[model samples]
Target chain A: MDAWFQNEVTYPHVAQEVLDAADSVRATLPNKYCDPEIAANLFAEAIDEYLLCDDLGINVICTEHHAGINSLLASNPMLLSILASQTKNVRILSLGTLITLRPDPVRVAEEYATADVLSRGRLEIGFVKSGLSEYASNQASPIDNGDRYWEAIDLISKALSHQEGVFSWEGKHFTHRHVNIWPRPYQPTLPRMWSATGDPSTAGDVGRRDMVQVLVLRGPEGTKTAFAANRRARAAAGMPKPTTDRFAYAALVAVGDTHEEGVRMGEKLMWFLNTSLRSAPQFGPKLPGLAPPQAAPGLYRTKPAAAKPGETASAAANAAALMNITAEQAMARGIMFAGSPDTVHKQIMDFHEAVGGFDHLSMIGRSGFMTHAETSKSMTLFGKEVLPRLKEVKTVTAGYNQPD
Target chain B: MTNATALPASGNLLIGDIELEVVRRGVGQPMLLLHGFQNIEPDAPFLDMLGDHASIIAPSHPGFGRSSRPKDVETVYDLVHCYLALLDSIPDEKVSLMGFSFGGWLAAEIAVKAGRRIDRLILVDALGIKISGPETPDIFDVFNKHPDEVRKRSWHDPAAQAPDYDALSDSQLANISRNWEALCRYGWHPYMYNPQLKRWLGHIKARTLVLWGASDGIVTPAYGEAYARLIPGARFETIDAAAHHPYLEQPRAFVDRVSRFLKS
Candidate 1:
């Protein structure tokens, strides 16, 4: 389960008009209602609660996003390093360091390697090709995102593992005469790698290289197909068959004492989903040359067919459709799991049955305008009841409760 | 050649590995028309009106309209070199070069490098110079706007008919997409203007005409004025009741202004 130290000062106080005008999810709402002083307090409270999750035997997931208040935290490595120092045994999954945006992949290798060493090798690196808004804000072209990501990963891997100590890289996106890093890695080999994406081929792309696949909000059917494709790709590449530990599913999760309490918590999660995730991550920003010609439509969920007469499915229409998904619909489709611990447990088991067993269940324990007290309660309940119940349940594919 | 009243003969003119769709009409001193970012319809009314004065040689910019976009022709610098090669390939000693908006920027760039090759240079509603005073509208802002807002800001007629994008064939849509990408490739870095271009304005020797549309919210008439002020002996004129595409909006007046200048 992941505990996000989200900026919650004005979460409950967000005006109706702010949410209404947040049509693209990229638009920044006025921060007049927000008090920056409360942010430090919020972070402190989250840190104490997340340390509690560590004590209760739960591995925490950390991720990154930029520019907007949608995710106030943008530096994953910085956050993870702080968590690593704060805790003793809890594993910190840096659910990603964005590979595509890095001007220097060597810096990425150095930063995460330092984090891994500081954590005494408890860090799991998740490499992400960040969302389009990140590209837009950074002035990085989305057109070159795919190639840049692949190139960055390749260079970072070689930099981390090269026995020769110093090497040169002359790739299409990056070129360095001397590719070497100090304090190579805490682990004997390069640290465990993960790639999170909605595209099915990404699962295979990672699987072929023995990296874990972090399946994002893609639904159950899509997950099943993605997993199968991954297995096939690994086999085709002559790599050993992927175990269930090689897959992880991320979902918006909340647990309460009662089912009704969980639903109440879900209202906040729904707000986050409805407003922040509305237009962004809906269809990728359509930067030209971002994807290959054939991969373009799938990469960016190109314009959907119009539901209304004479109102063609323009960019605005697509954003409207994304914002239209109700919490109930999301729960019914297994996109979210919000209920009592027992209810959430059942949904997880059901998801495991549908897409085979995956050891890591990346949970969004807190979202929307959830307070520190409420979010801590949810995390505590999940770690106490849910984590213990799922400990013995062997992954159907790998027959292990945790990765080797 | 057909009578001056007849429309231009349009065909693909392969220049080396690249093929540009060129439209030639009338017969007299060569008057080259470098179109702006948008597609130049072969039989546009304004082109016909201009054809009455001098031979109109209109070629679609690479990666625009039906022209073949070689991967090598990616930047404004590349375009300048390509066009220079194109001028050398032709037998004409000199040609009158006129450009609108994006093409106007290209014309200015060419004139700076090789002004001797052009007999006259005309720029209309051009965007390539950065002024120091008030902040100008970012040309990239057009992408952020709704198509309706873009059209309203770009033209005097808010209801002006545009290509029915939804009804366009896949190939046509692809061409628009290509042109847009090429535009990004060319203009995304310096953001529609060269930082040092102002220094080179003194090198231009051709008789220069700077035209503008009074209502051009895209670049604003002030942008046009600043551009003309920099060029030596350049004459600046504004057409009433028009915006970015003055030729499209006020064809008769636009042609009359250009014809009078060329004949002078």
Candidate 2:
């Protein structure tokens, strides 16, 4: 298993009363609340952490969100460039720069190529089918965003891999008359592609494309379901079944000297769900094309219904389940692993075993209010103690055990 | 051209590969009713009232009701072209084209292109042109604003006029969602207006009437007046105690006001 460390550089300094009063904590929140001095310190510390991960021999990840306290990384390529140029050894994955929101995917291709060259071919490209408040901030329509997402991926992939000079792309979502970048990617082929999705439909696409699939915060059941869909889709397509290496699970990971300390730190990570997910109706469930029209009964009716919201149904549904979740509950469901090194390891392996075994463990690191010192301490401990044991778990052919 | 009556019949119209859900009623000169943000509900009282005077042919735009929308049919331009094709299919010498809100935008576009095919044009709280300065938007952003605010802006008395979603059936809710999705796909960029439509409004050959809800916060009476001024010989009128959806809010007054214009 390969462990990747990630930090969202969350801003939790806003007054609780202000957060309570705002219709949305993201996109709609005024920029006046974001203190630049504090943001600078956050960037500095987060960069230091990335560098530390490089030294400790753990892979690093950079993700992007806009106009929100959840993350200051609005520009993934900017951070990708920083990590590409600064970090010495470890692989850097951009999980990534909301490609669907961008007006031009060719420009994204150029940015990725530059990062790849700077990193000496250590970059791994990842796509996120970004939605919700992101649509509002980016001024991109949420409707048909999926069509745009896949088209951007195709354009970026072709732009990177196609050696034959200037090519033209006329796609439904994007059209470029002349598509040529100055520098081709460092790797002969495009950096091993990754897509972050847990939905069965998107997971199937990931499987067919053979890209690594990362499921964030979805516990064993949801993860197992998505993996099964991936395997099933590949089999149906007459493609070889992907091994465990193609599947990855992301969760909050906080390792400490003692169990209580780790659990306490892990609880801090809950702020991501507890606060950052607060979005207005227009930017949340009401966003067009976020779900099928058939899902409208669940969304539009003011009266509560008896149907249990399946965890893997959609991100909005998943967000509802995650909000207000306790550290113990998160652990029991395999959404988190926090304890002494032995306990954290046991929790991870148990989760791995439960979800039919995945080779990549994306350890979503410190979140809101987790201080720089504490974050580094946990990372160092996790890197030094838990990672070696995880590495020993060999990649196996993936399979899904259906819940009876 | 007579097809108008008090009772309406629901059926499907096949236009090319697309099958459109349509309602036809009454027995008089042909009147093509272009619905607004939402498709005209079959039970909406104004439809039957309007049907009593003129034959009313109301088809839900692609992706709106039980309509089939091709993957490529996602823009207002596509809608205008589709409606133009529908006009060609009509047996009438000329059809009176009436549109509400988003449909008003479509009617204006169709009239601009349809030429002699459109005899009389009516826009009810229509949204198709820019009538304000760049910084000041003319239309309320229904998709971005708070739902309470949107509901309040949509009706003179939201408590009575606003839909109680809990009371609606699953299919009704699904239709609402489908309409919303289609609206967003067609109107999300440049925000429910065609930048060039204002410039072309003068070119419309059809005799025009622009109707508005006096209490419409979505698009004010002033914007409707400005819209009328842009179209040659177009007259502007407002219905009292009505908001964005005057037809649904005050069906009798809406029909009477429209009936007088059609006669004149």
Number of the predicted model whose TM-score against the real structure is largest: 2
- Indicate the worst ten consecutive residues by lDDT in candidate 1 chain A: A1-10
Backbone clash count for every predicted candidate, in the order shown? 1, 8
By lDDT, who's the top model here? 2
Write down the DockQ of candidate 2. 0.78
Off by over 4 Å in 1: A1-13, A21-33, A163-170, A175-179, A201-204, A235-238, A278-303, A306-322, A393-404, B1-10, B70-73, B133-140, B144-149, B161-174
Deviation (Å) of A98 in candidate 1 = 3.5
Model 2 lDDT per residue over B94-141, tens place: 789999999999999999998878999999999989988988989998
Among the numbered candidates, top DockQ falls to 2
lDDT of every predicted structure (CA atoms)? 0.71, 0.89
- Tell me the deviation in Å of residue A399 in model 2: 2.4
